[model samples]
Target: MPAVTEPKLIAGNANLSLAKAIARRMSMHRGMSVSLVEARVERFNDQEIFVEVFENVRGEDMYIIQSTSNPANDNLMELLIMTDALRRSSASRITAVIPYFGYARQDRRAKARTPITAKLVANMIAEAGVDRVLTLDLHAAQIQGFFDIPVDNLYASPVFALDIEHQFRGQMNDLMVVSPDVGGVARARELAKRINAPLAIVDKRREKAGEIAGMTVIGDVRGHKCIIVDDICDTAGTLCKAAETLMEAGATEVHSYITHGVLSGPAVERVQNSVMKSLVITDSIEATEKVKAAGNIRIVPTAPMFAQAILNIWGGMSVSSLFETDTLVPIYEGLYQRS
Candidate 1:
C-alpha cells in the first residue's frame, strides 16, 4: 500500500466495464489507438477456431483482462490469441487478468480416464506465451499448481468483509455465515471469522448436473440470521434449496453471497421466487439485464482489489497478505467437535 512504480495496462475483448473500473482505480485512462479485432473467426461450415491479433504490442507489458465465464470456448480462444499476439509483437511480458477462471471445477480426474481440463487450460495459456496469471477465487486452490509460470490467486473476502461491516452496522452479532454446500464450508468459515460470527454448513448432495437435493443442517440455526457463501452461483439450484432448508430449520432471515454471478437458465426466475432474503455477488462476470433488475441480487465491485493486486505484482509486494484470515480453520475445528 506504499508508493511504487506502476505498470501500463492493455485490454482485449473482455469485460470493458470492469477493465475501465480497474483503470480508474489505478488513476489511468483506458489506452487508446490499440484495438482488439475479430480475427477471421468463422464457423467454417464445420466447428473449429481461427484467430489473429491485429495490433502491434511491441515492448509493452500487456495485461489481457478476459473472463472465461459463459461461452467458454470463445473467451478462452480470445485470451490465447490475444496473448499470442502480444508475444509475437515482442511485448516484454504478458499477464492474463482472468477474473473468473472457467472449467476450474474439473481440476482433477474425478472418474477413471477423465481429463484434468483445468491443467489443460493452464497448459494452453502457458503455450500462448503468457508470462504469468492473475485470477480470482479459483474453484480449487490446487489449480495454482497447474501453471508453470507465476500465478496469483486473489481473494474477494476482504472486500466482502468491509461491505458487511458497512451494510449491517450494530447488528453484526445476530449474523451467521452459512455455506450452501459441504465444499464451501471453509470459505464461509473464513468470512464468519473475519466478521467474528458463528458458522453453519448445508450438507447438500448433487443428485445430477443442475439438480441439487438433500439439505442437512450441521449446526444450530434456530432464530439466527443466515448468509450463505459460495464461489459461484450458476443455476441458483443449490443456493435456493439451501436457503429454503435454512428457513425450514428456523433461521431468522436468509441471504446469500457468491463470487461469480453466472445466472443462467431459469436462474433469474429461480432467485426471484426463492426464500432467500437477498443475494450478493462480485462483478467478475458482467451481469445480464435480468440479473441487473432482479430485485434480490446486488453486485459488489472488484476493480480496486484487482488494481491493488496489479500494483502488488508490478511492484514486487506480497499478495498473500490480502486474505488476512486464519479464522476459517479454527471455526471449522469448533463446528466439527464431537457432540
Candidate 2:
C-alpha cells in the first residue's frame, strides 16, 4: 500500500515501563519523534476489557508493546482487542511486540487429554488481525510455526553475554555456563560459547510440573564459578535446587541469567534464601515489588535491542543480524551502561 512516515508504537497495561523505554529508544533512531499511541485500555466493572484509540492510525504501521505475563489472559485480550481496533481503523500493518508470551509452557501435550494452549493462543492472535509477531526467547521455538504470520523470536543471549563479560572480566577461565536441565543445554551452550567458558548440565528427573525428584551434575564444576542459563524461571524451584546441587558438587559459586522471570508463588523467597550469588533477568516481564526488592535479582532492559528489531523490520532489513558479534557488542555495551 502506501508509504508510512514513522512507526506507531502502542502500549497495553502489561508492561508500560518497557513500552515507554522502547518508545524512547525508537525516538533516538533517525532523530524521529516517536511516542506510544494514546489508547485507553480499560476494563468494565465486570472485568471485561475495553479499548479506544484516541488518535487516528489509519494507513499507519502499528506496533503494540504488551507482554502476556501475569494475568496472562487479560493482557492477551488487551493485545488482541488492540489489534482488532487497529485493523478496523485501517492501519497498514499491526505487529504484536509481546516481550513475554505467557501460557507458552503448554506448547505440547505431555500427557493424555492435555490441551496445546500455545497453539490456541497463536491462533487467537492471528485471528485477531495481527500482521506479524515479535517476541523474545520463546519457551519453544516451534511456537513460531503455530502462527501463520511472520514471527521474529529475539534472544537475550547478547545482553547476558555482555553482562557476563563485564561481571566476570578477569575470572573468565574459572567461569562455567550451566544448563539446569537437559532440555536447555543448547541455550546454555550458546552463552558458554559467547563467553568462551565451559558448559555443564544438571541432570534432573521430574516427577511432575514444578517438582524435581532427583538431580545430579553431568560435568565437573569443581573450583569454578557457575552460571546457569535458561529461558524462563517460573517458580524458582528447579533453579534453586540446581544451584544447591551445583554448590554441593564443589562449585565455588552459582549465578543464573534467565530471560523471563515469571516468579510465581514463592519464587522470590526461594531465590533470596538460595545458594546462588545473583540472578540476572531481562525486562521482558515487568518486575513485581518483591522481585525489585530482592537483593540478588537484577534486570537488564531489552528496549534498545527491541527498538533495533522494530527499526529493521520497518526498514525491511534482516532481523537475525541483530545477534551478530559486531552488532550485539554495541547493544551489550549500551545495556551495560544503562544498568
Candidate 3:
C-alpha cells in the first residue's frame, strides 16, 4: 500500500534560528521534508512590509512559524499574507506558530476611547485563512477565547523550570518565585510549584505605557533569592523597579524570568545596570544584537516543546500530556534521542 501523506513544516521571514531549532527538534531534514518557501519580505515606498512566497505549497499541510515581535505590524501582515497565499494555493492545512504574539496586551479596552487591538489582530488572523494557531505565552490567557479556531497555548514555564533545576540542582530551597504584578501571579505560581518554592507578588501601579510607578513588595523577601516572573519585558521599567524594590526589601538576590523579551527603547541599558542579578527570557521573539550583548540577559529555548507539539498533532497523538510533567520521563527520553 502507498504511504500516507506527510506533514510539512514551512517557515516565514521571521526568527530563522528559532524555526531551524524547532525543525531540528522534530528530527526532520531541513527544507527537505517540507516546502518552506523563502518569503522575500520587503518594504514599499509607503513603508509597508511586502512578502512573496518563493515556492509552491499546493495541497500541502503548511505550518508557518513567524513571530509578530519586532516590526510588529509588518511581521503580522507578513503572516497574514503568507496564510492567504497558502490558502490560495489550496494547502491542505495551515497552522500559524507565533511564539510571541505582539499587541496581545491590548486584549481589552482599558480606557474609554482605546481600541482592542489584540482582538482585532485575532480576527485578522482568522480571516486570513489560518486553520489553527500555535503560540506561546500570550500576554493575556483570555485572548484564546477570542479565536474561533483551536489555539494551542504552549508554556515556557516547563522549559524554564527544567533549566532552573539543571542550573540550581542543590540550591532550590533558596529560591522564591515572585510575580512582578498581580496579573503575573499565575505565571509565577506555576513556576514556583515546579521548583517547590514559595511564591511572592509585587504590587505596582502603572502611570503610563512603558512606565511603572510606585512598586510595593507584597510578600517578605528578606534574605531570600527572588526570581521575578513576567510574560513580557518591553522597556524593563516594571522589572527594574520591582528588582529595586526586592533589593530594598532585603532580598538576597533578584533574578527575573520572562517569556517574551520585546526590549524596546533603552531597555538593554536599564536591565544591564538594574539590581537584577540575571534576566532570563525565552527566544519567542528574536533578540536584537544590542539586547543579546547585555551582560545581564539570558536566552532560553522553547523549540523542543513546540516541535513535540507539532509531532503529536501530526501523529494524531495526545498533546494534552504536555501539561502533566510528573509523567514526562518518556517524552524527555524521546527528546534526548531526537536531540
Candidate 4:
C-alpha cells in the first residue's frame, strides 16, 4: 500500500513564483521539506493546452495555483484543464487557487445584451470539476454567488494593515483612507476603521469604460497624508487622477493600496508620472517589468496568507480568524498625530 500524504500543491504557468512561495510557507508549517507536485503543462503546435500529472494524486487533496492574469484566456484555459486532469486522476478534491480572477470586472452587465462574463467563468470552473475555489480580493464580492462550489474569498487588508502600522506608526490619526471613487467607499471605510483613520471619498463619474470624467473630494483631506484603497488598479487612470485631485484639494501627500494591480496599457507610465507618493499592491498578479521599473510601486506578498487559508481548509478550520492577531488588541493601536 502507498503511504498517505497531505494535500498536494500544483502550479500552472501563470504565476509559478507565487506558487513556490506558497509551497515554502506550507513547508514551514509542515516542518519538513515538500514541494509542488510533478505536473507538465504545455501547449501543442496549434496552441492547444496539455496537462499531465506525474504524481499519484489518487485520494489526495489538490490545490492548483494559477492566476488568470495577462494572456488571461490562455491562463484560464490552463486552470480548467488542470482541474479536469486532477479530477480524472482520482484526486479526492481539487481546489482552484486563482489569485487574480480574470473577467471578474465584468461580473455584471452595464449595458443591454452584454454577457455576465464573471458568472460564465464561474460556471466553466464548476463544470470543469473543481471542488472549491481559493482566491483573493475578487473585483466584486457578488461574484462569489456566481459559483455553486465552495469559494473562499480572502482579503489583503490584514497585510495592508500591518504595513500601515509600520509605515505611519507615529501619525495614525492624521492618516486618512480615501476611496478613489464612490464605489470603493466601503473598502476605504473598512481600512480606515482598521487603522482608526478618517475616511474620505472621491466623487467621480465614469463617462466611459476605462475612463474617469471628473472627480470632487467629498471630505476634507487638507494637511493629511491620504491612502486610497480599492480592489483593482488596471489602467491607473482613476488612481492617478484621484491623486492629483486630492493634492489640489490640500492633501499633504497621496498613496494607494490596491489589491490587484492589473497595470495594463499605460498604467505604469501613468503611475510613474502621477503625483501619488506610493502605490502598494499585492502579488496576486505577477508584476510586469514596467511595474517593477516604476519607482513608486511596492509589492506585498500574499503567499503566506493563501498558504494559511489552504491549511485551514484542509484541516476543517475557520479561515476568517486569520485576520485577527494574537493579542486581541485592536488593529488600530498606534500613536495619533492628531492627538
Top lDDT hit? 2
Question: What TM-score against the true fold does each predicted structure earn?
Answer: 0.86, 0.97, 0.91, 0.94
- Give the clashing pairs for model 4: none
Best by TM-score: 2
RMSD to the native, candidate 4? Answer: 3.8
Cα-based lDDT at residue 186, candidate 1: 83
Worst 10 residues of 4 by lDDT: 328-337
How many residue pairs in model 4 have overlapping backbones? 0
Flag regions of model 2 displaced more than 4 Å.
Answer: 1-3, 332-339
RMSD of each: 6.9, 1.9, 3.2, 3.8
> What's the C-alpha lDDT at position 151 in model 4?
91
lDDT of 3 by residue, 220-320 (tens): 88989898888999889878988999999999999888999999998899999999989999989887899788898999777767787776766667666
Scanning candidate 3 in windows of ten residues, the lowest lDDT window is 330-339
Off by over 4 Å in 1: 1-6, 28-56, 206-210, 324-339
Ranking, lDDT, top scorer first: 2, 4, 3, 1
Say which prediction, candidate 2 or candidate 4, comes out ahead on lDDT. 2
The sequence of per-residue lDDT tens digits that candidate 2 reaches over residues 1-339 is 323568889999999999999998888875978989998999999999999999999889899999999899999999999999999999988999999999998999999999999999999999999999999999989999999999999998978888887788778899999999999999999889888999999999979875778999999999999999999999999999999999999999999999999999999999999999999999999999999999999998899889999988887888999775558666545545423
lDDT of 1 by residue, 95-156 (tens): 88999999998999888999999999999999989998999999999999999999999887
The model with the greater TM-score, 1 or 2, is: 2
The true-versus-predicted C-alpha distance at residue 49 of model 3, in Å, is 4.2
List the candidate numbers ranked by TM-score, top first.
Answer: 2, 4, 3, 1
